[model samples]
Target chain A: MIYFDKVTKTYLDNLKALDEVTLSIEPKEMVTIVGHSGAGKSTLIKMLLAEDEPTTGSVYFESVDIHSLKRSLLTQYRRRIGIIFQDFRLLPHKTAYENVAFAMEAAGRSDEEIESDVPYALELVDLREKIWNFPSELSGGERQRVAIARAIVNQPDVLVADEPTGNLDPMNTYDVVQILKKIHDLGTTVILTTHNKGVVDSIDKRVVTMEKGKIIKDVKHGKLTL
Target chain B: MMTSMKRILRAGFLAFWRNSVVSVASVFVMTVTLSVIGSIIFTQVTLQTTLAQISDKVDVNVYFVTTAREEDILAVKTALEGLPEVAATEYVTKDKVYQDFRTRHENDSLTLQALDELEENPLGAILNVRAKETSQYASIAQFLETSDLLKKNETPIIDKVNYQQNRAAIDKLAAIIASSEKIGLFVTAILVVMSILITFNTIRLAIFTSKDEITVMRLVGASSAFSRGPFIVQGIMAGLSSAVIALAIFYPLTYWLAPFTTDFFSGLNLFSYYVDNFPQFFLMIMGSGIALGSISSVLAVRKYLKV
Candidate 1:
């Protein structure tokens, strides 16, 4: 579960990136955040990840204030939540298996555990066949799948996918969306941000729509109503 | 903990091997820096050896009158040897001095006949005093002038102290040694600092290419240490390789330069010095390489680890 208590983020030029926004997500909920570019979707995700501090208010994971945690404690907290990016920010030099295993390794997993679990995570994302392929060798869709596998390999309590499908084709996007739903059904809270209307419509779960740094609508089983 | 360490090392080797061009560039730059350091060491040693030879050629000689008692002259030699500034004192007997003078003018028959016709030997016993440092000769000369050992029964027994005659050369040599040392140290410091900066910037550029990977690692819940460990390992590898390369370069370099240096420095061989002090040189070069590489990597990776 996560809570944003009237969080606001202002840049140097007094531009409000997040303007007194408040939201909450329950455990095991797959919430898709939909907004156009510069609508504060990524800013909200960054606040949750503690990559950016809220200017005026607190962002909390469960009961602890995420931004107030010490560096070591923050790292431990982040380990419980895996994140993927639009760029599929995999280390280009590593293969699909190594990329996924890297996340597990960061969590201090044993070699035996990585050897066993990495393949399973890749299978979950339907990327097991390309396990040994480097990012350069993989197609864009396969790379996104590897990124997805990496994000969920550690079995984090929450998965944050920031515009993960932004660089994928429609078919690949659909596959990614399906994989995200499957991850949610397997009892993990999922937080996804995107400008794609079809992604929100297909999810058919909770949707939080943003406009000009403010959350304009929150709907249960909602459509993309921008 | 073992698992993490193993993973970090594996990641480091992976990155190092995968980015061969960058790794090679880093090693090359590090080798150049280390070679400069090694050269500074060799230069300093060679300069010191040459300076020591020059210092050895200059000393104060005391000539006593033939009438001066041998016991008095011997006492003077003992006292001069007691001074900390005096490195050594060679006592030449009056008979030996007379013989040396005869031998020198053997080809000049007229001078030899005049010396042989003399009723008594005129040459005095000499006490050759060498100072530990060229700068200490003036003080030693002053000590001889003021010490009571040169006088017996309130009369001066010594004929002459050659210090005043050699004072100009001694003073100039002292100045040369002092200034050369200072300038050598200054130039070495500047060169070392410049090389370190260049090496650091080169490593920074290499890490700059991986700035995005660092962010991704941080976001994936890797601790700062986890993300930083591999780069540190990579740096250490570059350092080690460069050290070996630099040392390898020095081997043939010192060997080829040895004959010329021996000829120029009056038998001080560069190759022999390198071989004799190989262990120390290895430690210095290796230590410097490791420190430079690791510190630079740590600093360069810090900016991107914030994510």
Candidate 2:
């Protein structure tokens, strides 16, 4: 369970990135955030990741304030959530398999766990055939899938995807969306942000739309009504 | 814990190999630094040996009058030898001095005839005194000039003390040795500091290229030490490799310079010194390389790990 109660983030020049935004999602629920550029979608995710602090109010995970944790505690806290980016952010020198195993290794997992789970995670994203291919050798779809495998390899409680399909072709975007659906069905809480109308309509899950820095609409099992 | 450590080490080695160009650059800079340090050691040794040879060539001689009794001369010699600054004293008897005089004139008939016409030997007995340090020669000479044994019975038996004539040369040599040591130390310190700075900047550039990887690692929940471990290990490997390269370079370098150093430094051979003190040199170069590499990596990686 994750909660953001009345969070507000203000940048220099008094620009409000998030304005008293209150939102919550239960465990095993998938939520889609739809907004144009500069709609506070990434800022909200950043707050949840503790990458940025709110100017007012606190973000919490299961009743624990995320920003209040110390350095070591913050690392442990972050390990509970998996994050994917539009860039895929895979280490260029590592193969797809190594990239996935890197997450498990960071979480102090043993070699036996990595050896068994890494292949299984990559297989979930249908990237088993390109296991040893470096990021440069992999296609954009395959790289995003590798990023997906890396995110889920450690079995985080929450998966956060910020514009993961922003750079993908239509076919690749569809594939990434289907994979997100499969992951949500497997009972992991998913928070995804995207501007693609088709992605929002296809997901048909709880949709939250934002304008400027405020959430203007919240619909359960909604279509892209923006 | 062991698993994490193994992962860190593996990642380090993998990154080092994957980024070969950067790794090579770092190693090259470290090698240059180690070489500079090694050169300083050799230079200091050569300088010390040359200064010692020059100091050994200087001493003061006391000439005794022919009328001086042998017992009085012996007593004076014993007294001069008692001083702490006196390293050694050689007594030349009157007869030996006469023999040396005759040998010198043996090449000229006129001088030999003049020497042979004398009833007894005209040359006096002599006492040669050497001091432990060139600077202490002045004090030793002063001690002899003020001692009561030379002016006994209201008449001086000592003909001349050669210290006054050699004082200027001795003082100049002492000054040269002191100033050369100071200059050597100053230059060495500057070189060492410059080398460390250059090495640090080189390692920093290598880390800068991996700044993205560091951010990705931190975002993926890697601890500070976990992320920093690989860079530190890479630095250590670079340091170790450079140290070996520098040591290997010193072997042939010293060998090539041995003849020149021996000729210029009065039998002080650089190659022999290097071979004899290989262990000491190895420790110094290896220790400095490893320390510089690891410390630079730690500091450079810190800025990127803040995310």
Candidate achieving the largest DockQ:
1
List the candidate 2 regions with Cα displacement exceeding 4 Å: A12-14, B62-133, B146-160
Per-residue C-alpha lDDT of model 2 across residues A1-226, encoded as one tens digit per residue:
7999999999998999999999999999999999999999999999998888999999999999999989898899889889999999999889999999999989988889999999999999998899999999999999999999999888889999999999899999999999999999999999999999999999999999988999999999989978
| Candidate 2 chain A worst ten-residue window by lDDT | A71-80
lDDT of 2 by residue, B139-219 (tens): 988888889999869789899999999889989998998899899999999999999999999999999988988988888
Clashing pairs in 1: none
Candidate 1, A1-226: lDDT as tens digits = 7999999999999999999999999999999999999999999999999998889999989889999999889989988998989989999889999999988888888888999999999998887788999899999889988998999888999999999999999999999999999999999999999999999999999999998899999998998878
Please report how far candidate 2 places residue A197 from its true position, in Å: 2.0
